[model samples]
Structures are given as structure tokens and as C-alpha cells.
Target: MADLTIRNLTITPLELVSVERFQGEKKRTGNVVSNVTGAITGFINATDFSAHHILPKGDSHDSRDVSFHLDPFRTVRTDVRSADPAGREVLRLTFRAGDRRYETDVPSPSRKSSVMKRIDGDDDVDDALDLTVVYVPTGAFLAIFSSAKLYAWMKQLDDAWPLPLLSIPGTHNSPTCHTALPSVRCQSVGVPEQLQNGVRFLDIRVSVNTDNDTLALVHSVFPVSLTSIKYFSDMVDDIYRFLDANPSETVLMSIKREGAGRGTDQHLSRYLKAGFVDKNADRWWTEPRIPTLGQARGRIIIVRRFGLDEEMARSCWDGRGWGIDGQHWPDNCEDGTCEGGHIRVQDFYDVTESQNIEKKIDYSRGQLERSAEREFHVIGPEHDHNPDPALLPIFVNFLSGSNFFNATCWPERIAAKVNPAIVEYLCIRHGEDGKGPNQLKVGAASTGIVVTDWVGANGDWDLIRCIVGWNARLQLP
Candidate 1:
């Protein structure tokens, strides 16, 4: 398996463009008597088309601007143009692999087309053609798959598994992709990409701009990036699109207040209630209880990290009474039970004084061990007779840490070093010998909601793979 590799995968789409043209003539606006001498004539206006025009004969046209790069595993590009000025003919695709190339005018199964009408005053029209490449493995690589295909494994699990019992992959500072600041930027991908790659948990920090009267996503005071920050409404729409497409999957979003505005928390709370929670209450799990896999499907579980005033609390729309409270959340507490077993946390982000990298890694392992111990108590004789998934506590682990002064302790740096170590430990059996400490036993109860930064960076997915692999024990003989 170490020597397994993908040789080549490429896709190219051809000839699918929409065009629209508009023409108008000038006319006299004054009275008929004043236009008796001579009337001014109107000329044809500019024409609009959905795609770019091909240059005349002997003139080279560059179509590279219309191309798109697909996923990291493969490269794909699409180009389209009319062969004649009359828009009568279209040039097709020529696929190239190795030293051979083949030209074909027939459309493949991957080709698709759609037309979009302009809603504004402009009469322009847009015709879009797309080609989707589905990579089907051949030879020995057929048995291999990436962690992004996690939905296939999740569908096989029992619907009775509580959301807290399963291990989940999460991203920290999930929407800071446009920011180049290493200290503040944590994620390399946007929310949609993260969701597509099996990230079920999101650490979203929001702030209210009182001047603009809009809710925006922010990471502390750093503005996230110089580029335009996404509005909270846009973020919600993106989540809805993903959930609507994949009904079997569920997302746990943790929202908190950032920035120094006076009534920012209250303002955000109101906007969320009026705009989202009130209108789409059915799509969300806003109750103050843990849910099972079957109950949470096609819904977004809210984890509010802000304080609610008395007025806001009285209203059912207040999200503070939702899934979990970040205020009551314990810091670095490894017992896996906080607020009398209502909430559990594994947040250990401070690594400034750590002598070596192994110290942070050991702390994470110890936390998971404690989480396993708590799960065992539920399965033990004390509560075995009356097992309830709702009463079971939730475990939230943070695999992200940083030290601003030392570049070696940045989020990416720590993740690069610690993620592999965690995967290696999870792969070993309880009695086997491995590097460092062996506190955690490899099984179904070993992990829960492991969150981190830069998840698909450098094509390293060992940590997420191990977390998903641990579920195999639940189906054993």
C-alpha cells in the first residue's frame, strides 16, 4: 500500500455557451411640430453574450481564463468558444493522456448545461456549461479511499448511536481562508470545502457591526483578513446548501461573540432569532438536550457561547438554551464531565511554556483517556440497566494550539507534529508497545469531536482516519 499511486486524471469540457443581444434606435422626444424639419435616428447598442468571442483568422485566442482546477487529487479545465462569427459552429474537446491525444465532438456523460437569466435591469443572459469528473479507481487502488468519503461509512452505523459517542472531525477558525496572517489565520479552506471533506464541527466566532447593522464572522479583533468578510446570513445559506444536498449528515456549529462592541452579543442574538432561528426552527435542534444520530439528521445543532439577557432568555428563540454553553465549559479539565455531567470539554490551547512537543501530545491523549473512562462508567454496572444516550455526557477535544512568539508552536506547526503521533497511538492495541504514553485504549469509546486547524494540509489525514476507524469496534462479533 505504501507504493500505491494514481497515475493521471484529467477532464476537459467543450462548446456550451449562451448568448444574448439587444438593439435599440434613437427617437425624437419633443412634440411632432418641433420634429417636422428633421428627426434624429437611434443607432444599435452593444450586444452581450454569456461567453467570450473567438478571435478572427490568424489571431490567437487564449481560453485558459475559463478553466477551473478541480480537487487536489486531480486537475480539470473547461473551455468553450464559437468557431465562426455567426455563432454557427463550436469547437469541442481534445483529451490527452501520456503521449496520445484524441479529438471528439460527441458530448460525454460528464457534460451538463444550464441557463441563467439576469434579474436586474440589465437584459444580459448567462449560459453555463460544466463537466464533472468522477474518479473511478482501477487496479489495486480500488480498495483505497480518502477520509473525505466519510459519509459512506457513517451510513452503515446504527441510527441509535448518540451524537456524543461518535468521533467527529472539526475545523478551528473555519472561515479565515482569505487572511494571510499566520498568528490569526487557522483554516486553509472555506466552510463549504471543509464540510465536503468530512468536517462536521465548526468553530465560528461572529461579531455585530452596529454601524452597518449586520452580523459578520470574525476571529478575535484581527478582521479575519483584508478581503471582505462574509456576512452571517451568507454563512447560514452555505450550511443550508450542504445540509440540503447531504441529508444524512449533521453539523454542530459553535457560535461565540468577538470584538469590543457594547451590545454586540445581544444584537447578534436578536438577528439570529429573527432572521434564522424563528423562521427555520424546524431545521435546527435548539432543545436543551443531547440528540441521537437519527434525531440530528438534516439539522444544524447550535452550541451558543454567548450570554443571554433576561429579556432574550424569556423568548424561545434565544440560542443560549441550545445544545451546549461555552461559559460553563471547563478549561483543561480532563474528567470529561463539567456542570454535573451536562457538558464536557477538552480545550487545552495554551502551549507557550511547553518544553517539548510531546507534552502537548501527552495532554491530548490523557484527555481522550478520561473521556473513555467516562463512557465506560455508562456501560458499567452502575448504569448498565438503564442506558440512555440523552443522559450521556458530550466530549469536545481541541487538537489546536499555538505560541505567537515561536513559529515552531503555531497551529500548523503543532498539527504537523502531533496529528501523526495521535494516529499512531490510536492504531496500536491496548497491550501493544508504541512511542510515548499509552494511556488510551483503542476502541469505540476512545475519542469524540476532535477539532484542529488546517485539516487537509499536505494531504495528511491520519488523525481523521483513525478517529473514523475506531467505530469498527461497535460492529464487531
Candidate 2:
């Protein structure tokens, strides 16, 4: 028996039959007991299994009869055993293929296991288990699944559902991953890593470096780091690579201008047009309108947070004319929709005079609730009124905050307080108790993009998981 490399090792409930001996009575269907401890046991050939079995010789021919061993791979049922009761359960699996029975164990999701390994021989086995299986808690499955898998699931939804209707997890100061300065360093991982880890929106702040005639990523007024750092072009190249590898997905990049220089906005705009946007026009969604998933595939939707001068706006590839101009995006507006229901935002980062953390949570929640409220559009004439549920505006919730005093209110600290609450709020809204199927649904009218900092810092992904899991409800039945 060779070590069998396993992939896609998901765990599902099993109903086992129980037998009792009393006064020499044979076991009957009514006497069977069910295991209620949620213990995982055994393996089944999920790919190829049927309920019908061929009738043996001298037996009444009834192909419809359900066979006791319906699964072809169940011949070695006796080999299956209950997992250990210690820290986390483990299920040992054994399956036969061409006179060889390979063996392996499904590791606990709580403990990180080697998802992929190089095997010595047998190309067929290698291909069979190429996709690694992970057993996560029912509600947090989306956190473990790859971004490519999540996009495939999104493709099943109605094409009319615009991007704003979805719950998108984003990063605040996305390209500040390399900064060593504590106050300025926002993310511990770079843009490419964040994108691959299911981040769909990126908060990019760019500045025009007059010295080198180049565009660079800036945090406030200074460069991203005290040392050599990434330029805006570098960030764009990384984005292009990720998009090329995963063509089914789209990215919403909120670009804002920062740093000091005369006509910096125009300079940055011209640089982006000639260097980046012009070359990748087809790869971008430049129209100032919300696009359906089908229309936005393999593209980057620009969300310009800076004003464009006349010259810059007239340029052939001006981003200000792209997707949504979040420039005059109001600060802390509780109204659900802004710009005549075209844009929605929740950026209440001013916590200077706040008395306690509760006030911050309350303010943030209020903003989120406002975004979640339903909006409608008139569909008929004035005499005969018909109001249909309209596609909600793009909701950009800034879950990051800071103040001169108490650096504790920094983006990372604020996320620590708000992320868990957001998860809990979603669980309550979806009526999830963590024991059954997670009915995680953030309808087109609810929570939109959640921008945070230091996500996955200290291994805390509950926020991202909750946001991603919300899309699980859209899966095809």
C-alpha cells in the first residue's frame, strides 16, 4: 500500500445503521440508532455511486431495489473507523485502483496540513487528487476555498445583478504592504497576495514624483516606505498578472491622488493614461456606469477618488471618466444613496472627539445599515405607478479610523473591534446558528465593499470569510 495523496477532502455527515441484541431478536430497521455527536467516519466514492444493484442468481430481478452496498468502493467498509477524539478528528481513507489500494488521512482544518505533495509514481493517481480538499466549519468554508473557485460560483448568479449588489471584501491602503513605518503600514501582504486571497477591491493612493517623472504609491504625504518602495506601475503590472491568470474575475480599484506637487492630479492622470490605461484599454471597464458581472469579466473597474482638470479630463484615457467618480463622495453621509443613487459610501474615519469605542461601532453600523436599506425605481407612467427594486448603488464602507491621540484607533485596531461585530451582524441577519447550512446572503440591496487594514494579521480572517460566505447563498440549487 502506497501513501495516497488526497485532494478536495471535504467532510459530510454520514448516517450509520445500529444493531441491538435483545432476547435473540434479529436487528431490524426500526431498531437502528443514529449518531448524534456529529462524528465523521468513512469515505465514499462520491464521483461514481448508484443506488441500483444487479440481482444475484435465483433472485427476483428488480433493478430498482436499493442495494445495501450501493457504492462500488464500499467493499472495504470494514476498514473504515471513527476518527480520534482528541484535539481534532482525522478520517483515514483507503481506496483501490488497478489492484493497488492507496491510503491517506483527511487532516483537521484547524491544523494546517501540506495541501499538495509530489508522489513517486502513478500519474493517474496524481491527476485524480490534484485538487486538495479542506474540511472547514460549515459557515467558514469560503475562507479556505480559492478565489478562482469563488468566481466560478458567482458566474451562476443572474447576470442582471450588478457588482454593487455583492458583498466585496477590500483592503485599505492596499499597496502599503512593504512599509516598515508602523503608523503608515496598512497591509502585511502585497496586492497580488491579497487578490489571490479573495480580495476583489483595492484602495490605491497614487502620487506624482516630480523628481523622476514617475507615479508612486503614497501613504498620506510620504512615500509608502522609508526604503525603496513599489511604484504605481509595479502595482498595475501585478494586477495585470493576476487578472491574466484568473480571467473570470474582476477588480474594483479605488484610485485617489495624494502627496504634494503642482498639478499633481493632472500629471498623475496623464501618466496613467499614457503608461497604463492606454495600453490596457480592453482590460479596463472605463464607462461611468455599473456593469454586470458578464460585462466586467477580465477587467479592472476604476473608481476615481480624485478630480480631473480640463486638460486631464479631455485626455483619451482619463480615469476620472471611468466607472464611478468617487471624488465628491460625501464624508459620513448616512443617506443610503449618493449622486442620485449612482454611488454609495460610508467613510466615517474621524474619531478624534469620540468618547469610547462603542460610539465608533455605532457610527459605522449606522452607515452600513443605511447602505443595506432597499431602494426602488418607478417603472410605469404617472397615472399607473409601478415601482421595481432597483440595483443598489455601490456601497464603500471604510472600516478604518485614526486620530492624533490614541494610535489605538488606527485602522488595524478599529478593524479588531469592528470586523467581529460585522461577522456577528451578518450571522444574525442570515439566521445562522453555525450548526447547519449557512444561508449567508447579502442581497443586492445590502452590505457592499468592506475596506479594512491588516486583515489576516494575527490569523484573523473572520471578517473576510463572512463577506465571502455571504455569496454562498447564490450558488445554483
Candidate 3:
């Protein structure tokens, strides 16, 4: 239980070592103990093994280089912190196993606990492995399940930074987490859990019932949950709780009109105004333009997927009170721009069969590549002084697809194939593993906001971690 385990995801034999440390109580002449890549028996070999590491009793800071014996020996210098920013005792790690090098923050488990046991068993399961997957020339992954990094990942961002330049992790259908048909439910985790796991954007669909003037959370014509119907007001309450607890974070809302609503998008808009905007103006930002992180912290940045009603236009607090104008976005558009070039979207969700998921992945990757090459506009402490400049378009890429007739093309099924491939693509293309031009240029390239589905499924948050890690590029020189 004192040792940290390595779950090697590759077939190669890898060795992890520390190159710097003070003389310790333990004695060692050689690495007689082969934790990972050691032969189990004459006929069998063990893929996952444990390294003899005991957590420091105190929150002391140590610097060490994690070396891998894989081909072309690579050493990663990292600070070994005994605790994270929240003052929670943690075990910071850096090592390599498969075709990737990982830097992780693992919460120090109880003396009677094992890191691998918590990951594979009925323990605290909401903890995210704040893992950065960097592809090396050889070898893939060494897994770790750690702290709730998604709770406050944006605290590191500059207050002046634009939302478009930040690599925000979002869900395709943020609140569709319930017992329903495969096509109706897009997520397994609920709204609050999604935000805890580092998802910042929520894609919501609401239908208005004229009978009682209530809004129902829905996906197409069906309710989000067949057993229990969810209302739009309750979902907003969930956002309130998360943002109140993590004041450093903000939530972007993409609200569209769907389901069997007896009213039009205008009715839906009025219902939102009466329910959230007028009563709790402090928690909502209904501007038609993008705002900096400083302007939106602890607030919901609304991206109006529904049209702005003419009557409500005059009700603006600032004479333009509607949210980010996203009315009439062309369906199934690839690399399309709208609202006078403020937002660019790729929402091609038409993967008819399971085999055609590759096509959707290609389109999604293309959008990421486009966002990477953006002429970015950021406001930080530097030579730049103009607080607000002409806005640059933000890329909102949707890697979500489904076939109405084909059960094989449901959200979860498609995500199983697409998310891993996208994660691999990001690692390979932006590895930071000494591969020239295969990395995101620090403080330059941005992935914008990536809307996905089924995140944190079966203990996998590599995609979220990669997206959040890229924000480090903005922080670094």
C-alpha cells in the first residue's frame, strides 16, 4: 500500500527512476526490485507493477528528474510537491511507460489505502487524474487517479484572457445523464459531477409547455430522463452550486430549443428571462459578445442557441441584454462562421454507421488544427495595454454524432471510438517530448472550446486533462 503502482498500457518494458534526492533512511546498491517491465515468470511477464515509494510525511517540496530507460533515454525535470494548491496532501509524479511521458498530481491516499485500489474499486471515484499525456518516441501510458482538478482548473488563467483563447473542456449534451434510450442520453455523469471533473461548458436543450409556462430539459422530442423529467430551473441551480464553490471558474451555457415545446424559441427565451435573468441578474451574463475570464468568473456565460426575441431585446440591462448571438446557425455546418465572425463552429453530427465514426473524428481533428493556427488575441501582463481589442473568432468544435435509425451510432458508442482517437492525436501532434513542431508552441496555439460527450467514462479523463494542460502554454513564457 505504501508503493505507487504503474499500469503500463503498452507492451514495452520501461524503467522509472529518480535522479536527485537527499540521502535517505533506505539503502540500495542496485534496482534489484523490478517494479514495472519485470518478468513475472519464465513464461509470463507483468505489464503493471509497483514502485517502492512512500509519501512524504510533511508537505515538503523536492525537485527531481524522472528518467525512462526507453529508447533514446529521456529525463523529465519536475517539482515533486507533497501537496496541491488546495493544501490537500498529494503525491506529485512524473514518469514514462508506454509511448508517452506523464506528469500527474495524485492525492496521497490513507495509510491503509493503495493508489491502484482506489482507482479499480469502490472508493472515492470522483477524483480526476490531472494527467498530461505526452507522446515519446516509444512507450504509451502510466495511469494515476488523483485530485479534483476540474473543480478549479481555471484559477490559473489570467483575468484578462479571452474565452476564445482558453482551451475549455465542455460536454455536448451536459445534462442528459439518466436512464433513457441510447440516442437520448449523451452523458453518464450528472451536471454537478461533470463540472467537478473539469467540464466548463454545458450544452442544454429546453422545451416550453404553454399549459403551465414550464421548461423541460429534453433531447429532441424525448425528455432527458424517461423515469424522472428534469426541468431547466433545476439545472441552473446545479450551475449555481458549482460556481459558488469554485469562484475561480465560469460556466458557458449553450441553450437551444428542442423537445415537443408548445411554444417557439421566443417563448423559451422569455421563460429564461423570467426564470434566471430578471430574478438573478448577478449570476448571468447575457451579453451578445464574448467576455474575458475576469468578467465572467462565478457567472454563467450564455451562448444563446435559441433566437433573441424582439420584445426582449429592449429589456437588456445594457441595451443589448441577449447572450452570445447564435441564432440560426446552419445545421451540419463544417468550418462555418456566424454572428458577424464572432464564433466559428463545426457541428457535423451525422455519422450514420459505427464504421463512419472515423469521418467525424477527421472533421473534429481538422477543427482542432484550425484553432491551433489561429491568430490569437490575449490580454495579459505584457507590452499590450489595450484592454479590449477587436475580437477574434472562437472555435466551437463538436465531436458528437448519432444516427437516428442506427443504434450502433449512439452517443456513448461513438464517443468510445472518437474520444480515445482524439486523445492519441493530441498527444502525438502536441507531445512536448522533444519532437520538433509536434508540440503546441508556448503562449501561441489554442484549441479553443472542445464540446464532447461521455467524458470521465470508466475512469478516463485524458482528453479533459490534455485540453486543460494546453492552457499552460498561455501561462508559460
Candidate 4:
């Protein structure tokens, strides 16, 4: 076991099978990795690329059965340093099964160097076990991820699970975060990074420049960046790209009309329809009712905070009502409900001072408890594990709060306190990072959609990881 192995990735019991390597008509099928589990389990012979006798074209076989990338495609490995004719010691792995073929480097050249850390001469002490159901796009093998293993939590979930019941991580002012003003900027990462890290909900506020019908992202009255203005389409494009790549995942985008522009809520609605929604209609689900995972995959579930323009309401959404209407949602609501009562929130943002941060933390924990308590018991054998949608409410708990003068109560400052606190609370409440302990008492609890700010603060996405970890409750047999 000197190189890549499946045991290094997961504890799941895998059936042993032959791993074949091939190119064109030239095919070789044998136990490449000497171990028991179907994937590249046990130990893979990490050797120089030239020894493998690859084709002159460098193109390999397409393993029709369970296709994945081959190791040592065209780059040198940081770990393996050897001298070939090209002076590169690349570990090349070519796997072929049935009529299919796939091959790439073990530490994929396409992936960043951070993923390379996992392969240090067969030390499997890593986060592969933490993954709910992680898979690498570069390898598509198992739960072993390169960067952050949370790229796809929803993929493990049952497609029939309704949107309201799933435990989803989200960001407040997602796109606005670029590290500028503390009062306005609410996040550190852009929309794409947030989605890639398993954030499924996005809190968005847009300013409509009615003068030119252009949209700019805003947090309260201040622009996200002090030097430049970030536009609304920029955020939309980020979401578009993320969904395009990870179609198995979905985003519940909460769009509201607010900012330092002359744009009205009416103008905001029309612009979204004419500019983005209408053009790429397939990318969005505009209906008000909650959707099952099957229906929302590869699409954006619009949580419209503004009502549609009067005329479009009758013509659009197939008269199905426009988005999950949260238009009447009042400000700073504590365990508040929208007009239709489809949404429940705990957005107590009035933290005038730093000491009140504890109060804010308490409010957030209360909401998570409420959301978990209601849905946990019903999903047992009594409900056939398919609880009624009516019994489930969409819980939106905000760990975001701020103050103008209080330096400690600023957005980033507040997240420092709130984010870590919630992570600690959930771990204890849920117990030992697995479903068995909590599931026994509460039948697999859920925290619903949790919104926060300043994620990835010092490479710590624990809060997001914890929020996503709760989805294990829904993944039970």
C-alpha cells in the first residue's frame, strides 16, 4: 500500500471486482489495486508513467462501467519525483470496464495542490469519512475529495425529499462579500465558492438603476466593494456556472429589492424576468410551492422577496403564484412567518452592542431547535420515512446581525461569535457527528436553512460543514 487506495477514502464495505486498464483496442483487466473493494481500493502501484506502455496519442480507454479518471495524465506529482525521458515522474492510471474509458492523474492536474495533501504515501487520516456522499469530478470515484469535501451533500439525499425539510447551508449577502467595508460587506467568499462549499441558500439584495435599468448588488445602502460596484448579473452568472457544473445540487436564492438606486420592487421583478429568467427559463423553478429534490435539481428555486409586476403575475408562473412569496416578511422578525405562512424566520438583527451577540446566538439556537424538534419525530417508521409536506415548515434562521458604531457588532465581527457558537451547539445537540445517537432520541433532527456571514474565515468552514452534516438525518434507511 504505497500509493492511492480505496481504503484511504471510505469505511463503506465495497465488493471486490477487477479494475481494467485499456487504450483503443489494447485492453488490460486485472487487480490493479491489490485489495477487497471494487474501486481503486487497497494499494495501487504508483510507478513512472512510461512503464505503463500508454498509447502514442496519450488518449486512453473509456470504462463504460463506472467510469473515472486515470492517474498521472500529463503532469508531475509533488509526492513522486522520478526521472523519465521527459524528466517527469508522473503516476498514470488508466481504468477501463465494458465499453467505457476514463483516465487522469492520481492527484488530478485539474485539481488544486490542496487536494494533493490527501495522498502522502498512503496516510488515510483525513476528512473522507466526514463526507456525507462526496465525489470528485476529477476522479468521480468515492467520498475522497481534494479541497473541501462538501461540494455535493445533496447527491446522497433521496430525490423525493422536499425542499423544506432538507438541512441546507446558506450565506447572507452572498455575492456582496469581497472584503471591503465592515458595515456593508457580509461575506468573504463570492457566490461560486459558497455553492462549491455546500451552501444551498443565497441571501441577495439588488439595487435597480432605473435610469439605465441595470442592477447592482447591495447590502443595506452601501455597495459591496468600496473601489468597484458588483452587479446583479455577476451574482446570477456565478449561480449559473455552479449549477451547470453540479446539477445534482440546487440553490434557494432569496432575492429582494433594496440598495442605493432608484429601482422599485416592481422594476426589480420585470428586470429579473426579462433579463435573466425569461431567456434561460429552464434554469429556474418559479413556482411558490416547495419542490422535491427531483424537481429542483439543475435549477434555481426562486425565493422572491418582492412581488411580481401586476401584469406578469397573471401571465407568468402558469398562474401557480410567483416564487415562495416572502414579500410581506417584516424586518427583524423573531420566529416570524410570511403572509402565506410557508416560511418561518429568526432574523433578530437588532444587536445594538457587542454583549447582545450572546442574545443573537441564543435566538439562532432556539430556531434550530424548533426546526429540528418539529420534523424529527415524524420521519420515523410511523410516517414511512416520507413525512407529509404540510407538517414541515421552511425554517430560515439568520446568524447574521450588525450595528453601525459598535465595532464588535459589525458583520464580520458578529459572524466570529455567531458561526462558531452555532457549530458547537449543533454538535452537542446532534451528538457525536452521526445520526445514530440523536436519531434514537429525536428521529434524525434537522436545522433547515441556516444563513450566516464571513465563511471560510481562516480556512474554517466548520459551520457550513456542520449544517450540511445534519442532512444525514434525511439519508437514513
For every model shown, the clashing-pair count is 1, 4, 4, 14
lDDT of 4 by residue, 358-454 (tens): 9898888777876776543335543444555633569999999989787777887788778767765664444222233233334346788999988
Writing each residue's lDDT as its tens digit, candidate 1 over 294-336 gives 8888888887776654576775545435445554566654434
Question: Judged by lDDT relative to the true structure, which candidate is superior, 3 or 4?
Answer: 3
Among these predictions, the greatest TM-score belongs to: 3
Which 10-residue window of candidate 1 scores lowest in summed lDDT?
Answer: 41-50
TM-scores of all candidate predictions against the true structure: 0.63, 0.63, 0.71, 0.67
Residue 401 alpha-carbon offset, candidate 3, angstroms = 0.3
lDDT string for model 3 (1-477, tens) is: 223333332223344543222221212222655532233421121112233333445443455665545322122223332233232344445444343333333432221112322122334435323333232211222332222366898886788777887888899988888888878878868889889889998899888777565888999999999898898888888889988899999999999988887888778788888878889998988877888888989999888877766788776756664888778675887688876567899898988888788888887877777777654444455625235532777789898998878877888778877877777555445323323233333224577789998886534566787677666555433
The candidate that achieves the highest lDDT relative to the unseen native structure:
3
Candidate 4 global lDDT: 0.63
Evaluation by lDDT, superior candidate among 1 and 4:
4
Ranking by lDDT: 3, 4, 1, 2
List model 2 lDDT by residue over 168-203, tens digit each: 788988988774555577776788878877788999
